[model samples]
Target chain A: MATKRAQKMEETRAKLIRAAREAFASKGYAAASMDELTAEAGLTRGALYHNFGGKQGLMQAVVDQIDQEMVERMLVAQARAASRWEGLLEEGVAYIEMALEPEVQRIMLLDGPAVLGDPSQWPNQNACLLRTTQTIQALIDEGTVKPVDAEAAARLINGAALNAALWIAAADEPHAVLPKAVEAFRQLATGLLQTEG
Target chain B: MATKRAQKMEETRAKLIRAAREAFASKGYAAASMDELTAEAGLTRGALYHNFGGKQGLMQAVVDQIDQEMVERMLVAQARAASRWEGLLEEGVAYIEMALEPEVQRIMLLDGPAVLGDPSQWPNQNACLLRTTQTIQALIDEGTVKPVDAEAAARLINGAALNAALWIAAADEPHAVLPKAVEAFRQLATGLLQTEG
Candidate 1:
């Protein structure tokens, strides 16, 4: 009975977060009202206050949740690949795919920066950059990539990947962007890492 | 005598655009006011009206001017390079460098998207994309780059470049980002294009 109640509570919390994400993404942080958010979540204002403290707290939670989800997705994509170059390529493609998902697009690219004010200071950016740098270092150590500075390479790749996501999100035809970007990324990766043709 | 007068007027117009660019870049579009802009330019409201029709018109002119400057700079960088690969690398570096510049950072990355509504419909985006596509196609046709879909590659590169610029603009240490990004770009580009080690 306790377990079932816990699960239900968790689901409710998730529902609230999802509703808040949509509200913030569409209206921006400054413009979105707490009343509207609670109504959308189908929860009472008191419940929201008890759960999240306030709007800033809710926004932080949304960012944290999205960042965790992105990391997990990236790890899965990297692990599934056969070669280091292939892994990197798949990772890039996976990022674009994730960005194209409506919820992810709305929360991560559009609303996250818009609400956060200064994107460089966002916790998600630092976490993402650290993860990316570590990945690049691993690729270099494995001899899958060139002996260039891994930190620098990671920053560039992360920047590129993030940009690709944002562009895909902003475009009218988001679906069409990934294949082309993936192809270029594959070629770019192979050229940078492989010893010879 | 008339030609001299016309030249003087053009110089004044350029001064107004430069001042507006600085204002828009630093203050953002919504926060920046015409009174402040004129003050920054050392001109009165009467002069401002004579030069640009109003704030919206001035913003549009600023966008147009920046767009033209970026295109010209890119072309110049491409022209100065000794090889196609080098040119591409230089172009990437130049782009990051330009992004670090205070005015370019402010106008292009921040104010452009913030005030411009949807970028897809922006005439500047269309022209820029078209030019980029043509450039990539030419390089591919010349056997400078590997045989691939030029349009797709162009979009990917352009997207990456734009993102790098945006990141740098937002970063606390804007100067440090491009060197790393450009190095990574060099590796990526080399991997994509070069036929031999």
Candidate 2:
């Protein structure tokens, strides 16, 4: 199904995405120049335009790539946990920890939301939300979580986790602040557990 | 202590801050022009730099002003509620409601964070968090809430409310989405109540 020309196009797109990631990681979206990005990819301006509409397009492509990587990393962390509930907690905590990484912080959490608007509105950005939602739904089905809306819980938890991450990343002593974030997250999450039900 | 010159300088500062707020609220931080902003304030470029440093500084001032307004609005909402718990809930929900306003959405949430970085890091932005933290601390002292770390709880709640507001603001049907966000927020906050503890 793949012709040589199509294959070449695919390779070019991938190269541009890689280059854009480095640019975003270093100079951020605003400062990352178009000429610099194109040159970094070992491609011409025409190739850049043909693949992505322009700077914003390439920036979004870079974001999607980073988002996918973040999700994969989260899934890996989730998989390592021993129980579903623990796994879910691990996932939330992991989300906060991931925010500590410079690339994820600079690209996904900061520049991505700033440039692209709310991440929830993005089609591809839903992977993390959907995953969190499904986990909550499964917990509810098992009567572990209370009889609350799964999607609602997911949104609240995800929102809290994200904010905690932002707080920790910007904290003067991140190592000192992290445990506090996790403990508070666990306590808030407890509100929806099956105790009342 | 009450010199006319000092009073005039203060007025000039307030006027410039007001003008900057309108510029940022209308055009966002990046697109707002320095020349346009100073002219709108009926002042000169020298005044802007002399008072606020530059565009970034002026924008931070705008954000600080908006942050103060938002916190004052929250305090007023809290005062209106029947109980401390009710007041706290009102304050949280009101925060979500505030996100619906375009000015708050544009300047306080989106551009404010995008330009000034994490609002939590700002000197004056802590009023909201401090207010929430104090409320949580009072509730915990009285056993209205669990034994969770007060500051942690505040950060998590603030984060959730912020994210929920952003979600609702960008939703296709904000009215419909508002209920979902509030209901979800209620459930998450309830998880930390004394009953659960």
Candidate 3:
């Protein structure tokens, strides 16, 4: 039950976000031109300002959108896994691979933190971090993981995975680097698994 | 062996670097003004440009100075510990605590990466990362750590420690957050310990 004006407003906002994402992904946040973004969306500077309150607001919206998509992708990866531990591991690897994507790598991982500040302080909420903590908690409860602090474990693991992705992205031979990063991550995660009563 | 002129040139560079570090630490790289920095150093703007090409160049110099000092501090912490593994852990925790310092957190951790692009690609060299890799390799060689990939493990553990420090820096009560981060790091590192043949 939306009015015609409301529907048009929503469309304009979404259009601007998509346009801004493409700009920010390719050129980065600091270098991306507001004019180029507005033109790319087939809108004017007024439209961007009116819809987003300015460039910073637009970047926040872009971050929130990308963050939600990343969380959804992780959840799907987790569901596809055969075991809870496998699910956690699979979700992590998926996150690493997802971070390898140029758009996500630039917009979400690098530029996002630099432009918006710390991930924990982000206003949109870190759904991906939440999902990670939940999976670790489940593993601890099932005795699959050691009795470690779940949130702490999640942050450490997430940090490691993020850096691994950055390594792959920065490497001249990402293909060669991918397997090494994955194996290293596996070893780290496996160390957290419970070996005895 | 050195001329008086050469000695004066070295002093000028050091003075400018110190002035710029103070400016960048308080106001960040983008906001820091080159004119003010040179004036504060009691050096001419020409001296600033001659010694360091520009603002970006000055920040790079500051980053190198801080990075070297950080490695030195970590080495001292390691030497104080009884065992190599304990030394590595102690160095990591010391690193986390050092990162809590406003100057280190702002100049090195936050603005350093933001201005210089990825830490892996910084032109000054990541001496801290190299030290961590060397320590891990030594531990592996001594059979203190498992025979895992050394560089990979170093990158993962470094990433975890850096994130934990950032977490503390962002916390409202860093004192409360510090213990949780350290314990979580211990749990993660303990997982990496060699448990069996």
Candidate 4:
């Protein structure tokens, strides 16, 4: 349905993003060289600029790609859980666990927030937030979760998971830190659950 | 007894910190000019460099001062509470409330983390974390809180509070968003409580 020129432009954009992601994940945003990434993609600096504005723009695109992948993985984790509540908890834990991966830790967790303003304000994060908020509302309706504001609960829950991942990512011994973070995350999420008094 | 030279140096350091704080609070870290700050402080660039290394160093010093003050204020709020549990909740709410202040929001919540890396790794936060861990341990020992890793719980709780402050700081209508954040925080903290059978 598209012209050859338009299709080529799309290919160029994907190539640039793929190249940038590898460079960023390997050497970090600040340290990665733009010239090298463009060369790796078989493109020019002008192409990079025209396609992404600059390094920051490219970083955002790379982060968005990784973040979108993270959401999909989390959704799959949620779907695999035995119940909705379990799914929510599983998703949060999966997010924390994903920090163990070098790519996720380097790009998405550490460099992403520092390069971009706030994770909450990211366009990709909005979809994740919307889904989480809807789940919280449904849980509240089912009397599984408390009657607290659904969006508020979702933000706090997501904030907790996000910080935990950041913690794991920055730790010297991430493997050693993983269990404690996962456990604390589980305990924190329980606060939203409705207790049979 | 201190020498007159040392006394003068101390005064100079204090002057630079004060000047830098006002500039950073108003113009943010990136836009705030070091030249203007030093000029306003009645000091030279050499003096700022000698006292705090440079602009980033000065920002760190300013953040440390503000963060220490925040901790003291939160402690005061906790001490005013009727019970330890109430104090804990009050302290978190007080933290979120402080984000409304322009000075605190700009310096500590926004620019601080972006420039200085994670807040959990900050030296000033170490003191807060220590106190929080101790409180969580005490509450668990007294059967007022669930049996969870004290440091882990403290990190998650502090993380939630920190992110909530960041959220408030960046929100368009922070005042309207304040109540939801505080209430959700209260609910989250309740997750750590030891419910009666």
Name the best candidate (by DockQ). Answer: 2
Kindly report which residue pairs in candidate 3 clash with one another: none
| Residue-level lDDT tens digits of model 2 in B1-197 | 79998899899899998888888778877778888888888889899899888888888888888888889999999999998888888899999999899888888877777677787889795688889999999999998988888888888998888888888888788898898888878878987788732
Which parts of model 4 have CA positions greater than 4 angstroms off?
A: A22-44, B31-33, B40-44
Interface Cα RMSD for all candidates? 3.2, 1.3, 1.5, 2.0
Query: What TM-score does candidate 3 get on C-alpha atoms?
Result: 0.93
Chain A TM-scores for all candidates read: 0.78, 0.92, 0.96, 0.90
What DockQ does each prediction reach against the true complex? 0.33, 0.71, 0.64, 0.53
TM-score, ranked from best to worst: 3, 2, 4, 1
lDDT per residue as tens, model 4, B1-197: 99999999999999999998899888877678888889998978999988878877888888888888887888998999999999888888887788778898677766776667667788676566667788889889999999988877887887788778777767888788889889999988988988777
Q: Summarize candidate 1's per-residue lDDT along B1-197 as a digit string, tens digits.
A: 57997897787777788888888877766567878788777776676788777776777789888777877788788789997667666777777778777777666655555455334446666455556667777778887787766756665666556566666667667677656666666776665574743
| Tens digits of lDDT, candidate 1, A15-102 | 8789888886676555678888888888877867777787767887888888788778888998899976667777777877787776
Q: Under CAPRI classification, how is model 1 graded? A: acceptable
Best of the two (1, 4) by TM-score = 4
Clashes of 3: 0
Chain B TM, every candidate: 0.78, 0.92, 0.95, 0.92
For DockQ, candidate 3 versus 4, the one ahead is 3
Between candidates 1 and 2, name the one with more favorable lDDT.
2
DockQ of candidate 4 is: 0.53
What lDDT tens digits, residue by residue, belong to model 4 across residues A1-197? 89999999889999999999899888877678999999999988899999889998988888888778877888999999999999999888887788678787677666766567667788676566667888889899999998998877887887788777777777888888888988888888888889777
For this target, which candidate reaches the highest lDDT against the unseen true structure? 3
